[model samples]
Every structure is written in structure tokens, then in C-alpha cells.
Target: MKKAEVVLIPIPAMGHIVALVEVAKLLVERDDRLSTTIFIMHPVLDPSTTKYTESLAASTLPDRMRVVNLPNLESNTEDTKDRNWLNSMIESQKPRVEEYVSKMRTQSQLSPDSPQLAGFIFDTFATGMKDVANGFGVPWYVFSASGAAFICSMFYLQALHDGEGVNLTEFKNSDALLEVPGLANPLPAKLLPSMVFREDLLAIFLEHARTLKETRSILVNTFLEFESYAVHSLSNGKNPPVYPVGPMVKHVADGRDLRSDESNKYRDIMEWLDDQPPSSVMFLCFGSWGSFCGKQVKEIACALEHCGHRFLWSLRKPSSQKGKIESPSDYLNFQEILPEGFLDRTLEIGKVIGWAPQVDILAHPAVGGFASHCGWNSILESVRFGVPVATWPLYAEQQFNAFQMVIDLGLAVEIKMDYWRDFLGDNEIIVSSDDIVKAIKHVMEEDSEVRKKVKEMSRISEKSLKDGGSSFSSLGRLIEDMIDNIS
Candidate 1:
């Protein structure tokens, strides 16, 4: 049998691209008959995005793999000032992607393995892959960068056929608790993803949900055991098989001793962890795009100070109109944005940095809890390391992810919120320092039920990732399915 020439297309961001690169490396390393190539279709060009692509390409990989950073699509736009612009940008990028796929198909026709272009393994956000797969007459696999729960939520669209989708924004103002069929928890609509709340985005989701039937298979970055109900529900009668191959980070781990003289930048974080007491440090990071206003920042800082726990916080410099990192001269100073004397006072117990090695920090013995935005990737990484989460879902599917974490899976806890009273009060309601302080204490204190529940989830997480475990077996099945389908 000849090696299948598999092409990979991932979403534009650094994190998404890195995961796809790792998956391509794994496939090539596991099968001698597999050769992989990656086509990075970035929709925009900026300093950070450029650096992300370069860094990803620099990462270690199998010799048989190749990576291509393609030119930005002509239809892409930089106008993110309005939400409508963002939606238009996504819609416009499709034609440019179609053109690129046409060129790739033409090039593949010239290869020695001319007719063996195999199939496409595409990021979930790259919806244009369906058309590309149709052009080449090959199967298309949908790769989800998040957990199985996120994927299962889309299946609820079948219920939307009966009536209008649940309007979370309206529910947030009313007393109604939105009941999503097939979900284990009956959650308030305010706790749902923004897409589910906004009508325009809800339409987009419904369209995508319908597309699931066209997929050859769906691959999630999670284990079946961790979200067995979700995986089972989505796979029940679907044409596309749902494969839970995950904790995807494990595939990228080079398990030498943590003290090895490896030149990786994460080495410094590991060294710092060695000095802290067991489970004493809180790992604080919101995913790449999560941002907060100056007021929210101050409240978080105050909460951290009140907790009196050792912590490592990743603070990002906001971007200016020209897309450059805002300088100290712009707006308020960092100190002003933080609570009064919070940093100086907590210097003995906490360390604040612009960025840290998140995965390494979570795996450290000193790390007791994760204060996160509940991004799917971050949540999965926390689960993999047995680090309990203090979920503060900022946007996107994060609210839904947080709901599953606390209510469904009992893996973590969410900061309590009274949506009707808070956001729709007689006066404008705001989150206060008191709420933040209470939530932090609940997640970090040893006696709290939230902490105990997370500890139990951690044990289950360990078993899910072990050899011959759910995630491990799912990965093997995915590989075998692809190999068997190759002509």
C-alpha cells in the first residue's frame, strides 16, 4: 500500500493551528503509509498572527510532514469594529478558500499519488472544507478544537425544527429557565453561549448544525469517558461517526524529566513551581482572545488579593487602533487598572506575568486551581492535568462549557450569577468585588464542595487518559478508519 497524501486545513489562530500540526505529526508517526501536509489559511495578517504561524512551523514534527502558510484570502477584512462586520468577514472568506482548494486539487493531480489525495482533515470553523471535499470526491473530517460537550450542543438544532430556538437573551430578562432537550442540566438562558442568545448567530449555528450530516466523521479533542453521554447522543443516528480522541495535548508531550535541560521556554515555569508547596499556587489565564475592561480587571485583582493564595496571572497588553500593544502612555497605567496596591501587597504570595506556559503551569504539583474563561481547549487541558477550574466564561461557547463543567459533569464550579437581577435590574447591575472574592474562596478552600467535586473529576480524568483508555482507544479508531478508507 502506498502512503496517503493527506492535506490538513486548520483555523486561522495560533492555538488551533498548533493542535492540527500536532495531529498531523501523530498520524504520520503512527503510520508508515501516511504522509501529511498542512495548509494554514489565515484570513488576516498582523504581528501576533504572523508570529503565531512562524512559531507553529518551528515546533517539532515528523520528517514526512510539511506545512504551508498560504496568502491571506482577498475577501478577508480587518473591520472588527462591529459584530456584523465579523459575520460578514467569515461569510466572505469562503470564496477565497474555494479558489485555494481548487488550486490544491489541481496540484494534487500532478503528484505521483495523483488519484490518492485521500481526504481532508479540517478545523470545525473551516466550513468551506465541505465544498473542497466535494470537489475532490473524498471524505471530509471535522476536527473540533474543544470538548465533546460543545459538539453535542449543536445536535439540539434538530429540536429547533419544532419551534424557534431558545432565546437566551429574552430568558435572561424573564423567570423562565431554558430547557434544552438532551442536555443533562436545565440552565438559565443567560448561561448559554452568545451565539445561542443572538438571533443572527443562532441562524448561523443552525446552518452549521445541519451540515453535520454531510461530514464523513467528527473528531473532538476529548475522551469519550469524560463526556460519554454527549458523544453517544451526537453519534446515535448520525451519518458521520463521532470519534473522541483527546486531551490532544498528551500527543504533543515529550515526557523527559521536568528538570531536563531542554531549551523550551516553559522550563522557567517548571523551575518556579518547584519552590511552592503542594497545591498552593493558583494558575490564572484567560485564553488568547479573552479580555476584560479596566473595572473587571481591578475586581479580579482584588479577589486574588482576598484569597491569600499563591498565584500566577497572565496579563495581556491591549491592542491600539493600529494593532500595536498599547504603551504605558495610553489610558490608565497597569497599576491603576489593578486594585489599589493589590500587586505590591500580594508580591510575596503571587507572581504576575504577561504570559506563562499554561499547560506546564497546570501540570505543576504546586498548582491547586485554574481561574479560567472556560475556553474548550483550556478546560480540556485543566481536566488532563487534574487541575480544578474556577470558571469565568467570557464569551462564545464558554458559558455553555462552564455550565457543563459545573452542572452536568460536576468537574468544576461557576461563579454564581443572578442574571435577571444583575443584568436587568432597576438600575444597571454590575459584578462587585464581593462576588469575585466569594467565588475564588469557594474554588480554592479545601473544605468547599466545589473543590471536592473537582478532585473526584481529576481522578476520573487520569483514568481517561491512560494507556488503553477511552481517549487512547478513540484515537486509534480514528486512525484506523482513515487508513481503511484510503484507496
Candidate 2:
């Protein structure tokens, strides 16, 4: 029998791409017979996007895993912030993705013993792989970059919206909560994904929900210990096999060593951190797509000034000011986005860089707390390094992730679960500087529950990847199943 060569497709965003790369690396690491080729399909809106792909190709990867670039697709503008826009981008790439994979299959057929594509795995947005796999008679799986809870909610959103007559727009202001299947709690409309508002986005999610049910299995980047109820909900009935092989940063963090980030430019930041006391500094960073409006950035600056603790903020250009940003480095101009004297006020207590070496900063002993956008990958990284978090969700299903971390996992405290409240009109309520300061103080407190819980989770994250651990054995089962399908 030939080895199983799985093609993993990730949606173009930085977070989605990074998660798939890590999972692809893990597949190659755990199974000798598994070979992976990841196709990165990015829209060349920025030179930096292409540069990122090239960097991934250049990274030190396992011998069995390789990264390849898919040709850039046409960028879409309308509904750009809407989840539907991303879904449409992925759908538009289907023809090319299929053509390329079919060509690879045909070429590999010439070599009798060469590893053949026994399976297809697409991350959440790339669930378009279901049709590609079906068209060519190959098994496929959906690898959600988020927790099982969000995946489950997405799977059931349309039913609640259409069949249950839940008016999503009305629910935004109402007291109704989504009684989604598989989730233990009633999710407030504010906590639900933004897809509920528009019929087109709901349709996209519903299609993926249907596609997922037809797959061989579903994979989530969360551990069983962390999401037992949600995982159980997904595995029940004819929902396909649900594998909880995650807290993925453990497999990808290079054993929690700060040297994993080799970028030389951030050495000064690390050196500055070395002077701080252990677990004394706070770190604030949203994801690559995460940026605050000018109003929010100023509020953050005020928060840092009032907190009076050593902090490192990875500030990006205001997402609200999209058209004004002409270059990738525009966010580096703090003076432009920040208020006069704001930098001076916080200079003594905080360091604001355009971007910080996140993994390295979190791994450092001196850094204690993280104020995060609740991107699933960042949450896993924070837990991996035992850094407690202040959950500050900005958009999409991030609010759900915040709930999972703060209420379900006890690993993080909430800065503002409904951080997007102001997103509609830009005047819901500025999470006051006082509120931000309190949240950070709570996260960094000595003997805090968040700290203790995160430390324990760090140990569990390490253990879950070793032999006989749930993730380890689950990965083994996944490989064996893929090979079995081939034979």
C-alpha cells in the first residue's frame, strides 16, 4: 500500500494559513506514512501576503511536509468584512484548486509507489474542498481553525435562522439566545457569528454545514480536555467522526522555546523585556487582521497609562480606516493614529511596536498577561506558554471563543466579550480606560484563577501530544483511517 499524501487547503488569511501549516506539520511529524503538501491560495492585495507564503516555503519543515503556492485570485471588495466575502473568494478558486489537484493526481499515478492523495483536508473557509474531493472520488475532511463550539454553531446556524424563524437582526437587540445543538450554553446573538445578519452569509455557512456532514470526519484544533461537551456534541449521531487533536500550538510551538521565532529585528524588544521582572509585563496584540479604530487605539493608550504596568502593544492601523492605509507600514506611525501626548503618557510603562514577535514575547518569563482578540490560534499559543489572557473579541466567531476560554476553559478573563458592540454605529460604549486597566490588572494578579488554570492547561497541552495522549492517538487514528480508505 502507498503512503497517504493529504492535500491541506487553508483560506488565504494569515490566521487560517498559519493553523493549517501547523496541522500539516503535525501530520508529518506523527505518522511516518503521511505526506502533506499544503496549498496556500492568497490574494496578492499586498506584497507582504506573497512574502509570507515565500517565508513559509522557506521555513524548516518536516521532510514529509511541503508548502506550495496557488496562483493569486482576484480580490473582492464588496462585503469585504463580511464572512460571505471570504466564502465567495474560496468558491471562486474551486476550478483552479480542482484543476491543480487533478493534475497532481494524474502525475503521481505514473509512479507506482509514490504517495497518492488519499484524502483532502480544508480549513473552515476552504470547505469548498468537499466538492473537489467529491468530483474526483476522494475522501475529504473539514479542519476547523476554531474550537468545536464555533464549528458546531456554524453547523446549526441556518436551521435556527430559517426553520426556527429566529430573526437575527432583531435578536441583536433582543434578549434571545441561540439554542444551538451541541453547545452547553445559550449563545447571545451578540456572541454568535456575524453571518446571521445577511442571508447570503447564512447560506454559505449552511452549505458548509451540509458539506461537513458528508465528509469522513471533522477536525478541530482544540483538545478534548478543553472542550469535552462541544466535542461530544459534534461526534454524536451521523455527524461523522470528530477528532479533538488540538491546543495545536503545543505541536507547533517548538517546545515552548522563545528561539522558535528567528526574526532578528525583534531582538531589541526581547532584550528590553529581559530587564523586567518575571511575569510582570503585560502584552497586547490583536491578530494580523485585528486593528482598532482611532478612537479605540487612543482608549487603549489611555488604558496603558492608567494600568501603570510594563506592557508591549503590537499596534496596527485602524481597521476602520481602511482606505487611508496606503502601505503595509502605515500602522507603525503611532503619532498619526494616537492622540497628542498619548505616547508620552504611556512611554514609561509600555512599549508600542508596530508588530511584536508574538510567540517569543509570550514565551518569555517576564511577560505574564496577554490582551488578545480571542483568535483561536492566539488563545492556543497563550495557553501553550502559560500566559493568562484578557479576552477582547473583535469580530466573527471570536466572541464565542472568548466565552469558551473565559467561561468554559477558565484560562482567560474577559476584557469585553461584546467588544463589537460599537461596531454597528461606532458609539455603543468605549470600553473605558478604567475598564481596560481593571481587566489587565485582573489577568496579571498573583495567584489569579486565570493564571493557575492557564499553567495547568500548559501542562495538559504538553502531555496531550506525547505517546498515548488523546491528540497523539487521535492523530494516529486519522492517518490509519486515511490509509485504510486508500487500500
Candidate 3:
């Protein structure tokens, strides 16, 4: 039996690495003749990233699956604010990756029976490593940690900018609607990714979209039933083949070793939820990097207090320090941010904590609604668990994700469709308590159409992983393609 190895390069963020690692595990587990090596490129801008990598490196993985941590480079404080920050950071690691791959190639050459390095699988942010994959005469693929809708949006925006000669900067406040391919409805121009309005940052992403056209395939973390129209749009035969193998969300049991404080907090949350009625609790959690200012936090506290729903809220302190990735951290004291007596007034009906066991909480019968940042993983998890969502997007492609769910698919209620938290402290829009209360009411309503739709989709999401389902067949195809190329 000939063995072949596929190399994975994932951005070091926990959210990005978690999904990629799950896919890698799925790949090697599905094929005995295959193995996977994941290369971790530390962002060097956030300590949370380092902690996550260390945890993942220490975890027990499946057979023939290995985690490799690259040597960390010194942090460059200047690029954190530069338009080219992400690109420059990724580019600096290329030489080291190249050297490592070259050594592996030499060792394979020297040995007669070792697994041949067959291909490169890159995270969306790590596409800069494509040149190194090319240097070895191997095909490179993209593992889209986001959904098909976002990838489709990227390509369409690229075409709109290059072919149609539109000034994208005008889109920041434009009232025009765009007929993007993946979305079923016309997209509001203002709801497009916040980066599209910035020329410098737009240049970086447009280049990524161009490079993606050259890949062997793009494995999107979405199922066909969820985004059939969007998936169909991407399968137009002009670009690389796309495979929808997802809802690749982590399970409640699949967690890292939590600190003692985290463990205690999680236990308390579950205990509180276990006492609540089925489908009675509303969960408010942003993604790993999601956080807000004191003003917004107070607004949410007021909203939660007014809504009168049994709620579990994960609140993190927004990063104020310079040169660090603007991720949120656990607040040492909640009173510093929340309104006075807000916690006491809502104490019987709500629980606010620093970090949440999101999956576990969602899986619990008490959870009926999610007020999420619309991160793809969080969206998938909410859908998978039959919980309706009230979208409160923060950054990246989240605003668009919110748009797709509310307008295109009618699967979730919406708070705001264009709220991008500008980390430079320019965020002026504050979603009022009244609007949040309305969305919460809509999501928790038992007979609401969105709730019905999410429940049905949750059932479909389960079947998509079974035999004869879309995601299962898609993953089988991806594995066969790799094996056939190797043979």
C-alpha cells in the first residue's frame, strides 16, 4: 500500500485552526493510505493564539496525523495597523516553510517507501504559501474556513472591481443592491465586507481571490442543502471545483483542557441551564475574536434586562493595547462595564460570564435562541442545534453572513446587517435595547418561520453527514481526488 501525505497550513487563530484541524482529522480517518501534517504559523501578534497552539499541539490526535509548529518570528509592531499586515506576516514565513518542505522532499527522495508529499492545503489567509507548493510541483488547494457565500462574494466583488470598473470605496455608504452569484437575493452594497471599501486592504483580498482560481479545489465548510444556490453559483466550471463538506463545527465533548476557573464557570452555567425549561434560554455569544466597548456592553445589559428572557451571555473585554490582534479577553470584573445593578436586576433571569462553553450550551435543551456575531462556525453550530439566531455581526464577512441568513435564506432574524466594529475605535452605531428586544422575541417565538426553518435545517445538517448525503459524498470525492492524483 502506497502512502501519501497532504500538508495543511492554517492561520494560527483558534477559530481558523479548529475547523482546519477537524477537516484534517476527517481526511486521514477516511483513508488508511493517507496521512496529514498541519503546519502552524504563529501570528505572533496575540498571546491567545500561542496558548491555543500549545494546547492543540498537546492534544491526542488520530493515527498518521501530526501537528508541526513553525519557529516564531519576532513581532513587528508597525504592520498591525498597516494594510499589508496580514500579507506581510504570511509572506515572512514562506521561506521557512519552503526550507521545511525541501528537507521533507529530500528525505522522501532518499527513502524508497516513505509517504510522498502529494499536495498542499492552505487556509484562506495562508494562500501566500501557494508558491512553495508550486516549487515542489504539487497541486495546492484552499480550505475555506468560511462558507461558500463569502467565497463567492469575494470572486464576484473582484470581477465587479476589475471588469466593471466600479469604484468600490463608494460602497461604504451606497444604497445600491448587488446581484452577487452565491446569494439568492440582491446584496445591499453597504453590507459587503467592510474591507472592500478600503483600497489598500481591498488589494490584498482581491489578490487572494485571483490566486484561488488556480487551486485544485476549494473545500468550503458548508453543506449543499444549506447553500444550494450559492454552491451552484460557484460550480460554474470557470474556477476550481468546489466541494461542500461542512457544518464542520466542534462538538461539546471536543474541548481543550480548560483552566480551573473556566471549568468552574462552565459547570455553573450548565447547572443553571439544567434547571431552566426546555428551549427557554437565549444564548448571546460572539466568536472567539468578537468583543465590544463599554458603551455597547452596557446597552446589551440593558437589553437583556428588558427582554426578560432566561439568557447566558459571554462577555469579553475588548483589547485596548497596541500592536496586538484586537481579540477580546475575559473581564476580571463585569461591573466595570455593565450598568449599575444591571446584573442584580437580571440575576434571576440571566447569567453573564467571561467565557462560554458555546457548543455545550447550545446543545442543551434549555437553549432556544442565539444572538451571535454571525461567524460561520457559530452560525453552523446554531443551525445544527435547531436554535434560531438573531444576527449581530461584528467583523470580517459576518455582516454578509447575516445578510445571507436573513435575506437570502430566511433562516435567522437580524439586529443589523452592516455593523462592522472598526477596531480603530470609530464605531458610532449602537444597536438599541428595543431592537435587540424585538429580535430576541422573534428568535424565541415557537411558531416563527425562522425558528421552523432552522429546526428543519438542523435535521438536514445531520443527514448531510450520513451516507448518500451531500457533505458525505463531497468529502468522499475530495479524498478520491487526492488518492487518484497520488497513484
Give the candidate number with the greatest TM-score. Answer: 3
Ranking of predictions according to lDDT = 3, 2, 1
Candidate models: Cα lDDT each? 0.68, 0.77, 0.86
- Model 3 misplaced stretches (Cα beyond 4 Å): 44-46, 75-78, 255-262, 321-325
Which residue pairs clash in candidate 3? none
Model 1 C-alpha lDDT versus the unseen true structure: 0.68
**TM-score of candidate 1 on Cα atoms, chains taken together:** 0.84
| lDDT, candidate 2, at 98 | 83
**282-360 in candidate 2: lDDT tens per residue?**
9998876566666777888888877788898888764454333222343656788877987787776678887656777
lDDT of 1 by residue, 1-487 (tens): 6556677877666567767876887778767877777877655433455666776588665777888776665555554434344345545655655676577568757776643567788787666557767776778888888777667666654355436654434544455565554367776656655666566667666666677667889988877767877777777775478887766664225654545636544566677778889888887787665445566667778778877888887765444334332211222445756777777899788876665567777877798888887878788778777778877776577777888888888778666433211111121334566776676666777756766766666677667656677766777777777776664
Worst 10 residues of 1 by lDDT: 418-427
Candidate 2, residue 200: the lDDT equals 62
lDDT measured at residue 81 in model 3 versus the true structure, 0 to 100: 56
